[model samples]
Target: MRRSQRKQEEPDLGVLAGRTLFGLQRELFTRLGEVGHPDVRPRHGAVLAYLDEEGSRATDLAAQSGQHKQVIGTLVDELVELGYVRRQPDPADRRAKLIVPTDKGLDHMAKSDAILAGMEAEHARAVGEEAYAEFKRVFRLVADRHSGR
Candidate 1:
């Protein structure tokens, strides 16, 4: 087979998938900024997504995000300064503080969900609903198996 045909037959899906996901993430961040969250950084996403409804401590955020406590603490501080999160006395630990999302943060989370839904709908339209469903299923399977879930 010709080199061009061989390349077409076995495209690098890893690169393509990564580019697609990150491209969407970039767009989401841009949209967030356009909607008045100019301070929200891409690095803050892991903490925000994993934050519990009640609240979480820096250590907990670190555990959930697979980051160091100091890194999570720094991100939490940034969130606090941005008015997205507030630190309150931790009921579990008197010396530590719990980070809770403010009303603005909750609104941003809701908007983020809507943005994701819109992107998924676009993917479905492009590849057909059934293909999109299969794609999601495959990704979930890979993630679950990879994570030993």
Candidate 2:
């Protein structure tokens, strides 16, 4: 095969997928800023959402968010300092701690949801509502399959 043909045959799916996802994340974060939640970044938002949904330990959040434990710990500390979240002693396991979002965190979550809803509406407008819904369904299926869930 010619060089060009070989290049075409070797699709860099991993690179392309990562670039696409990163681009979308950047765009979403920009929109979030526009929506007046400028202080919240994608990573912080992910941690908040995880705590809101599952209320896991710091170690678990680190694993689930694919962030280093120390990184998550630092972020959690920041969140705590900002009064968005608090760490309380776990009743079941005294030695362990459970991270819970404060009222401020919940408020932030509501704003984040509003921003994401606006983004989703824009996406539906661009791609059609039905198509967007189907895309989400298929994407979730693919994600679940890959994660063995």
Candidate 3:
């Protein structure tokens, strides 16, 4: 193939991957909402997921979530208002506060996990199991490399 044609034919894999992942996440969140869960924005979900994995200070969550501290603090305030999370005095630093998920937040995560499992099953069915497995493996490899892990 001519160099121009070869270059033209090269896949925009990054864009494709981003679109697919975002679509899947949107669909999963939509299904979750349909199941009567409050409409939490994707950013809030990221915050909740992060807190679930490891409770951290608002600044840490801001950095990890790629959101500004003000943005994260606002989101945390919303979560607290919704009774999904709480801010407690940090033992490591008396002046800092740690974000912790409430029982409600944990329960929401359990429900979200079930919804995500169903979505994953559908995705595997749509893209054959082998393809899904390979995609996951390759994606993880790329992620690990990018993160220097």
What is the C-alpha lDDT profile of model 2 across 8-107, one tens digit per residue?
6874656556776787778777876776556777678557767754356998887677788898998998888878789988778989998888876777
TM-score, structure 1 vs. true: 0.81
lDDT of 2: 0.77
What are the RMSDs of all candidates, in order? Answer: 3.1, 3.5, 3.7
Candidate 2 error regions (>4 Å): 1-20, 34-36
Q: What is candidate 3's local distance difference test score?
A: 0.79
State the lDDT of candidate 3 residue by residue for 1-149, as single tens digits: 98667655874667667787789779867876777665676778657766744468988887667678999999999989888889999889889889988887777777788988888888899999999989989988987776567
What residue pairs are clashing in model 3? none
TM-score for each predicted model, relative to the true structure: 0.81, 0.74, 0.77
Q: In model 3, which runs have C-alpha deviations exceeding 4 angstroms?
A: 1-11
Error of 3 at 35 (Å): 2.4
Better of 1 and 2 by TM-score: 1
Computed on alpha carbons, the lDDT of every model, listed in order, comes to 0.84, 0.77, 0.79
TM for candidate 3 is 0.77
Query: Best candidate per lDDT, number?
Result: 1
